[model samples]
Target: MPIIGMCIDLVAPSLPAIGQSFSVAASVAKSVISLYLLGFAFGNFLSGFLIDSYGRQKIIRLSLLGFIVASLMPIYLHSITWLLFARILQGLTIGAVSVTLRSICADVLPPERLTKLGPWFGTMWGIGPVIGPVIGGYLQVYFGWQAGFYFFAIITLIAFIVVFIVVPETHFNRHPLRIVSIKNNITEILKNHVFIGITALMGLSYALMILFNVSGPFLIQTTLHYSPIFFGHIALYLGVVFVLATFLGRYLLKAHTVEKIWLIAINVSLLVGIIAVIVSYFFKDSVILTTLITALMFISCGVVFPISLGKGLSLFRHIAGTATAVMYLVNISISSIVAYFAGFVDMTSLVPLAWMYLFLVFVIAILYWTVLRKS
Candidate 1:
C-alpha cells in the first residue's frame, strides 16, 4: 500500500521542481499525476478480467515486477516523455496489486473479520501518503527529483520480495477469461444503486484529498514561495490528521452507524466549505488560511473514506474482485479528472479550490439525503 501511495503521492511537493526541470507549465507537469490516475483506472478496469482468470498471486507478482521496471524507466531513460510513460505504467501495475490484495482479503476473511479490516486497510493505506511526501520532499531538497524515483524503485523492490515470500494465492474460484463475462459482471454491479451511490460519494470524498495533492505544490511552493521541504511538512501534518480521522471514524462507526457518520461528515464538509468560500472571497490568497481550511476539510473526508469503502465492499462479497476494481476505477477516475482540471484553475487564488469542494460536497449531500438514505 505504501509503495502504491508513494508511486502516486511522493511527487506532489516536487511538482514545481519537476515543471522547472522539464520546462513546462504547471498544467502540463500536472499531467504526470493525471495520466497515472487514468492509467490506474484503466488498469483496475482491466484487472477485473485478468485476476479472475489467472488467480491473485500470479497477477500480483507480474504487476509488481512491472511496477519495479516502470519505476526505473524515468532514471534510465532520462526524459519527461519517458517519465510520464513510466508513471502511467506504474499506475497500471499498482492497480493490479491494490485491487487484487483487497479481493484476496475479501475472499479469505469471514464477515466479522472482514468488517474489522477496513480501519486496518485504511491505516496501512494512510501511512504511505503520510510519509511518502515528507521523504520525497527531503529527497528532492537534498538530492534531486530523480532521487525520489530511485527511492520508489528500491522500496518497491523490497516490497516485491516480501510479497513473493509471504503472500499466498487467495482466489480459489477462478473465473474463465472471457470478454462477455467481464462486461456482464461490471454491468451487473453497476445496476446496484446503493453501490453506485456509495462509490460516487467515496469518489467525491477522495477528490478533496487529490485536489490538494495536485494543487498544493503550485499554490504553496510556486505562488507562496515556500520551499519544497516546507510543502512536504504541510502534507505530513494533514496526513497525520487524516490518519487520526480514519481511526476516529472507525471508533465512531462502532458506536454509531454509517448514516450518522456520513451525516456528520456532510455537515462538517458544508461548514468547511462555507468558511473556505468566505476566506477566499475576503482573504483572497492567504496560504495560511488555505492550508488551514484544507486541513480541516481532510478530517471530514477521512471520516467518510473507510466507512464508505467498508459499506461498499460489504455489499458484494461474491464479486469482490469486480466490485473492488469498479470502486477504485470510480475513485481514481474522478480524482484524475478533478486534479487535471484543477491545474487550469487560478493557482494564484484559493477561491477555485474552495468552490470546487463546495460544489462536490453539495452533490454528496443530495445523494445522501435522497438515494443513499435508505441504503
Candidate 2:
C-alpha cells in the first residue's frame, strides 16, 4: 500500500523539470499524472472481474511485471509520450495491487477486526505521500527525472519478489468468468444505496486529496515562488497531519460508530473550507495560512476515508474484490476529472481550491444525510 501511494505522487516535484526536459509546458506535463490516473480507473474497473475469475496471486504478479516493463519505457526512450504510457501502466498495476490487497483484508478478517485495523492501513498509506516527494526531490537533484522512474522500477521489483515469496492466494469464493455475470454482479452492488452513498463519499474524499496533489506543486513552486525542496518539506508536513489524524481516528473507532466519526470529519472539513475561502480572498495568497488550513482539510479526509472504505467493503464481503474495485474506480476517476479541471483554475489564488473543497463537502453531506442514513 505504501508503495502504491509512493508510485502515485513521487513525480509531483519533478513535473517542472520533466516539462523543461520535454520542451513542453507544465500543463502538458501534468497529463503524465492524469493519464496514469485514467489508466488506474480503467484497471480498477476491470481488475475486479479478472481477480475474481483468476486468483489474486497470479494477477498481482503479472501486473507487477507489467508495471516494471512500463516503468522502464520513458527512462530509456526519452519521450513524453512514452512517459505517459509508462504512467498508465503504473496506474494499471497500482489498481491491481490496491484492490487485491483490500479484498484480501476483507477475506481474512471479520467486520470488527477490519474496522479496528483500517486506520493502521490508512496511516501506512499516508506515510508514502509524506516522504515520496522528499525522496523524489533529492533523486531529481542528484540523478535526474528519469531517476524517479528508475526508483519505481527497482522498488516495484523488490515488491514483486516479496509478494511472490510471502503472499498466499486469498480468494476463496469465485464467480463465473462470464461478462454477463460480472455485469450483473456490478449492477447488484450499485443498487445498494448504502454502498453507493459510502462509495461516493469515499471518492469525493479522495478527490480532495488529489486536488491538492495536482495543484500543490504548481501553487507552491510557480505561483508562490518557493523552492522545490521547500515544497517537498511542506508536502511532508501536511502528509504528517494526515498520518496523525488517522492515528487519532484509530483511537476514536473504539467507542464511536463509523458514521459518527465520518460526520465529525465532515463538520471539520466544512469549517476548514469556510476559513480557507475567507482567508484566500481577504489575505489573498498567504502561503503559511493557506497551507496550514489545507492541511486541516487533509486531516479531516484522513479520518473519513478509512472508515468509509472499511464500512463499504463490509457491506459486500461476498464480492469484496468487485466492491473494492468499484470503490477505487469511483475514487480515481473523480479525482482525475477534478485534477484535470483544476488546471483551468488560477493557481495564484486559493479560492478555487477552497470552492472545490466546499462543493465536495456539500456532496458528501447529501450522500450521508439523504442516501446512506435512509439506507
Candidate 3:
C-alpha cells in the first residue's frame, strides 16, 4: 500500500523537467500521474480476482515483475507518452500488490494485530505521496528525473525479490485450478456486503488523499506560491498525522470495536469540513494553516482504513481474493475518478474542497448512523 502510494511521488518533483522534456505544459505533463492512478483503479479490480483464482504467490511474483519493469521504462525512454504508459503499467502492478498485501494482512493477523499493523501499514503507504515530491525535488535539481525512476525501480526490485523468496500462498486450497470453478467462485464472492462495504469505505478513505494528489501540488505550488519542497514537507506532516493517528487507533482497539473507530474517524471528517471552511475564508489561503487542517482531515484516514479493512476481510476468509477485489474495485475506482476531476474544481479558495469534504462526511455519517449502526 505504501509503496503504491509513494510511486507517483517519484515523478512529482520531475513534473516541470518532464514537461520541458516532452515540450508540454506542466498541466499536460500531469497526465503521467493522472493516467497512472487511472491504471491503478483499473488494476485494483483485476488483481482482486487474480489473487483469488491464480493464488497469491503467482500473482505476487508476476505483479512484482510488472512493477519493476514499468518502473524502469523511463530509464530508457524520453517520450512523455511512454512515461505515461510506464506509469499506467506501474499503477496496475501497484494495485495488485496493495490489494494482495492487505488481503494477506487480513488473513495472517487477528484484530489486535490488525490494529498494531494499522499505523505501520498506513505509514508505509502514506510515505509515498509525502516523500515522493521531496525526493523527486532534490533528484530533479541535482541528478535528474530519470535518476528517480532508476532508483525507484531498483528498490521495488529488491522488494520483489524479498517477497518472492519469503511469501507463500496463505489461501490453502485442496483443489487445483479450473476455469469453470473460478468463475463460479468469483460470482459468489461479489455477492457479499461486508466485502462491498469494506471496499467502498476503502475508496472513501483513500479519496481524501487522492484529492490531495490532484489538487495538493497545484494548491501549494501554484495557488499558495509555495515551493514543491515546502509542499513536500506539508505532505510529510500529513503523513505523520496519519501515522500517529493510526497508532492511537491501535491502542483504542484494545478497548473498542471497529465500529467505534469508524465513528471517531467520521467525526474527524466533519471537523475537517468545518476547518476547511475557516481555512478557505478566514486565513485567506495560508499554506501553513491550510496544510495543518488538511493533515487533520487525512488523520481520519488512519482510523477508518485499518479497522474497516481488517473487519471486512475477516468475514470473507473463504473467498479472500474475491472479497479483496470488491474492496479495491470500489475504493480505487471511486477515488481515482473523484481525484481526477477534482483537479478541475476551484481550490483557489478552500470552498470547493470544503464543500466536497462536508458532503462526503455527511453522506458517510448518515449511512453509518441510520443503516450501518443498526447492522
Candidate 4:
C-alpha cells in the first residue's frame, strides 16, 4: 500500500528535473505518471486472476522482485521512452504487491477486526506520501533525479527479503485458472450496487490526490517559483493533515455509519473546493493559501478512503483478491486519466486545480445521491 504512495509521490518532486534531462515538455514528462497508472490498472486485472488461481504469496513475492528490477531500469536508461517503460513496469509490480497484500488482510482478518484496524493501516500507507517527497526532494537537490530510483531499489529489496522470510501463504481456497469463472466473479462483483458505489467513491477520492500530485509540482515550481524542497515541505504538511484526518474518521466511525461519515466528509470537501476556487481567482500566487485549501481537501479524502475501502472489500470476502484488484483498477484508472489530462490544463494559476477539485466533488456527490445513497 505504501508502495503505491511511494510510486507517485516519491517521483513527483523530480518531474521538472526529469523533463529537463529528457529535453521534453512538462506535459510529455507527466506521462510517466499516467502511463504508470495505466500499467497499474492492468496489473490489478492480472493479479486478481493470478492471486485467485495461484495464491497470494507466490504472486506478491514475484511482484516485489519485479519491482526491484524495474526500479533499476531508469538509472541506466537516459531516454524518456525508457523511463516511461520503467515506470509502467514498476506500476505493474507494485500494483500486484498491493492487491496481494490487501487480499491477505481480507483472508486472515475478520470483518470486525479489519474495520477496527483500518485507521492504523491507513496511517501506514499514508506515511509514504508524508515522507516520499521529503526524501525525493533532498535526493533531487543533492544526488540528482536518478537517486530516487536508487533509493526505491534499495528499500524494495529490503521489503522483498522481509516478505519472503515472514509472510506465509494465506489463501487456502484457491480457484482454478478458468477464464469463465473469472468473468463470472467479476460480473457478480460489478453487479453489487453498494460495492460498485463504494468503489466509485474510492476512485474519486484517490483521483483527487492524484490530480494534486500531477499538477502541484509545476504550479509550485514553475508558476510560483518555489523550489522542489519547499514543495516537498508543503506536501509533508498536507500528508500530515490527511493522516490526522484518518484518525478523526476512525473516531467518527464509532458513532456513525460509513455512509454518514462519507456524506459529512464529502459535503465538507465540496465546501472546501468552492473556497479553493474563490481564493485561487483572487490570490493566484499565494502558495500558503493554496496549500491550506488543498490540505482541507486531503482531510476529506483521508476520512473517506479507508472506510470505503474496508466496506467495499468486506462485501466480497469470497473473492477478496479479485475485488481488491477491481477496486484499485477503478481507483488507479480514474487517476491515470485525470493525471494525463491534467498535463494539458493551464498550470500557470491555481484556478484550474481549484475547478478540477470542485468538479470531481460534484460528481462524487451526484454518484452518492443516485448510486450509494439509494443503494
Query: What TM-score does each of the candidates earn?
Result: 0.96, 0.96, 0.88, 0.98
Q: lDDT scores for all predictions?
A: 0.84, 0.81, 0.71, 0.87
**Residue 155 accuracy (lDDT) in model 1:** 82
Model 4 Cα lDDT, one tens digit per residue, 50-126: 99999989999999999999999988877888899999999899889888888899899998877756676677789
Residue pairs clashing in model 4 are none
Using lDDT as the measure, name the better of candidate 1 and candidate 4.
4
Model 3 global lDDT (CA atoms, 0 to 1):
0.71
lDDT of 1 by residue, 143-237 (tens): 98999888877887898899999999888888888878888888889999998888888878888888888888888888788898998888888
List model 2 lDDT by residue over 1-375, tens digit each: 787777756788787788899998777777777788888887887888888888798988888888899889998898888888888888987888888888778889998787677787888888888998788877777888888899989988999999999999988678879979888888989888788788788778877777777777787777888777777778788888888988888889888988788778887787777777777787657778767777887887888887777788887888888888887888778778877777566677677777887887777776777886676
lDDT of 3 by residue, 38-100 (tens): 788767668866776566788888888898888888778768778889988988888888878
**lDDT winner:** 4
Task: Please give the ranking of all candidate structures by TM-score, highest first, separated by commas.
Answer: 4, 1, 2, 3
Model 2 — TM-score against the truth? 0.96
Number of the top-ranking candidate, with TM-score as the measure: 4
Off by over 4 Å in 3: 16-27, 106-120, 174-183
Q: Model 3 residue 90 lDDT?
A: 87
